[model samples]
Target: MATKEFKLPDVGEGVAEGELVNWLVSPGDTVTEDQPVAEVETDKALVEVPSPYDGTVKELLAEEGEMVPVGDVIITFEVGEEAPEGGSEEAEAGTEAEAEAESESEAAPAEESAESAESAESAESAAPAPGSGRVFAPPSARRLARELGVDIGAVQGSGQSGRITEADVREHAESGGGEASESAGPKDVEVGTRPSATTKRGEESASAAAGGAEEGGAAPSGVEAAGRDRTLAAPATRRVAEEEGVDVDDVPTDELREGEAFVDEAQVRQYADAVKRAKAAEAEAATEAEPSGAEPSAAESGAESGAAAESGAEPETIPYRGVRRTIGEQMQQSKYTAPHVTHHDTATIDDLVETRTELKERAAERDVKLTYLPFVLKAVVAALKEHRHLNSELREDDDEIVLKSEYNVGIAVATDAGLMVPVVDDVDQKGLLEIAAEVNDLASRARDRSLSREEMQGGTFTVTNFGAVGGEYATPIINYPETAILGLGAIEKRPAVKEVDDGGFMDDDGPSEQVVPAHTLPLSLSIDHRVVDGADAARFTNRVIELLENPQLLLLE
Candidate 1:
């Protein structure tokens, strides 16, 4: 047959080896070209290897549970009628070795037949002369008969063709007189006295009879000749019985093996008792071995008390790896690289709330929901337009600030793992509904860890909604490579005065009717002082709050 050797192929970049997970074909099985012959598991993913030739499998060169290098021969196949001639010197040597093995096997049976004939002829010539009354028996039986001082021909044979077997010779010796009956002895004997030869033989007969009775009757009844009862169990049940300190052979396996190898209620109780005893011993040993002066440390005691106060608390630790690791490194680089200054302020949002409520009702008809985030984002975009310095970037090589006209805002979304900021490109060109939808999509993708690297990079400014999680105010760190980030806090309802057309003073006291409205969300701006001064940050925060409070100004922008 034409044999083809299949070599392992490179699966992926820099992967030198792969684990052979399973083999699909065995020796003598036929396989077609491009058919999956094996599955390999690499570090990243599982892959399949296909046959290179259509042929019957000749040999498997690599065994399962073995590591093979790439390009090694994994399998060989017999392809056609004619075997290929040796193409290399190594192939010729392998052929010679196969020929030598075949010759050895063919010679072994002939030599065994010759040896058997020689042994039979030697045995016939070695036989004793006639009248010696010797019997034909195996060498082992003859040796045994000599040791017992018994004549072979006198003993009855129970082997093939009436030949004397070892067992038959033993039986004849044990009977003490063969076919010739001897005289009996007295039935009674004194204590500690040695019995006569005849008495011993009679006693042996009685013992054999008793043993036969016990084997036929008592054993099947689960009772021994000594009146002790035992149970029957399977191998697995026997193992459990040993561990549980139960006598497996004495226990009835009927209940334990009823369609399944399961222990009954009594066995379960017995196991529990053994386990309890073992636990009690362990506890006692531990109590004895404990040092008298051993005590909890102050920190440990405090932590224990704290844990008791919060009974159901579960502590978690997350490794800063992958995206989170990148975030940590970037944040650290920003904090040390850029000198940051934070400015915070709160504005009256009564007008903004009223305007948003009016816009929301209209937005519903357009299949959109106006939220505070969009209003803040719109305000931040407008502020960027007004103060170009806030939207500026610093050049490290030239040590000069480069201000850009286009505004691209990135919103930071906090997730269970860490922070991710996805940018909204060209925010100035989008309308309110478009901005809202884009912001929603970005934030949702950021939270779900589906944002691409491009979506996360290239931004002029960033806004973080700390207020969503109950924080009143926070000076968010600047997402460096950019100038600033805005932090929004929770809004609360407070009493404030409004300009009345009638020119009357409105107080909290019932005299004029003060307007109790939801105030504007507090905003904190942290900017790179190297690029923009405190005045520039304050102006940017004021402009953002103004747009948030009077959201109608966003449409004008």
Candidate 2:
């Protein structure tokens, strides 16, 4: 047998360390090469490490939840007979033997045993029961057993071949003797009988603090304790509540006590309404507290209002340590370095809509549904080909511009967590239906956060659809490194001019001719002025509108 050390590998863009999220193997377990042995979470994504060699696990050098640097030895394997050795195996074995001997010698005295009567009694006390041998149990299960005063030796472990687990303890407790609930009741009863002097003093101090806070016109101290209850919720749940203006503390906890599992949607809405009312009341009170006086000067009032706003606002502090941090730095670099200008336009899409409707029916036969995004993407790509500057990037160091031949378009998709742009590569070569399918797949992956770093990188341009949210026009910020970004607004039907036969304005009946209104889509194009002038931007915008207005032109190379 021989030993081999497996070190952590670089898994991200220059990541130096990763936190060990989980270990899939234990000591003495046999593993095959390329089998996942551990999961490590870096700043970018969760990565799984595969076993480099097929062998029996000798030891795990790093514990789960511990952060290990790249190139550090994380696990050791005991190689089998078929394993290859590069050097003299005997010499390595001799060195390992000496080290093990030294370690054992150092540990022997601390674990020394005796055979006398007192020693025998101690040995007996430490020994296992008649039929039960040493049992493997998790720390949580052991803690639960101790709390419940349950003898682990008497309880049969039902987890993975008699190993004790948290679930086992919970099951036992639910069966009326395992641990949690049963232990809690008796512990509380016992605590009620004999209150500790320290607890009494703490209670007294808390009461005094609460009184002092109230007297000083500050919020009561108990309010802080109550606020801790809100911290127990998941971040997404908290965010939903905050967005809807819900006060979590005011929500009824009866469901939680009854073990109803999840927070009901109706309860969340009710709490949100309550929070809104409370905020309204607070704002009213603040307004009433203002002193009556002659109006101050505009500048002075503005300054005072700004100061008040700053004082009342809570600063949002986020640790710069993940994908979001990377995005933030990149966006800041792009915004400050690039000089941006925007142009807006509207296009009548009555023919385009009709074409889309016809294409959608045909597309369903091929298991693809035509969407407006694909048409828009195709139009953008076509326009980019005509306006080459839009597909170019500027170099700051040499003061040179490089025009890219490939058209990689990034579609901005909004998610519950934040915004993510997943790139669609070589859009110029892809058809409208193909682009739509790819856009759907990328957007889905983005929302699920399953997109790879490569899928998000190398975008030459970006498109953000504010139309879904009912926005008519918006000055969108250019996605950093990309020279321009296009914003799509909501499409609405409105009256438009139509051609009549025989070059006449009215029908043959002498009554005024009429036509159904067309759907108009609004577009806002934001460009980097450093790379493109207003005239170029206007021309590009006009080209994009031209393609959109005439859908047939979008299919052009």
Top of the candidates by TM-score: 2
TM-score per model over all chains: 0.45, 0.53
Question: Candidate 2: lDDT of 224?
Answer: 25
Alpha carbon lDDT of residue 500, candidate 1? Answer: 41
Per-residue accuracy of model 2 over 353-398 as CA lDDT, tens digit each:
8898889888889877567888888888888988888888988798
Model 2's number of clashes is: 2
After superposition, which runs of candidate 2 have C-alpha atoms over 4 Å from their true positions? 1-5, 19-32, 41-45, 53-68, 74-319, 415-418, 448-452, 469-471, 492-518
lDDT of 1 by residue, 183-250 (tens): 12112222112334443323223222211112123222212122213332222233344444434333
By lDDT, the best candidate is: 2
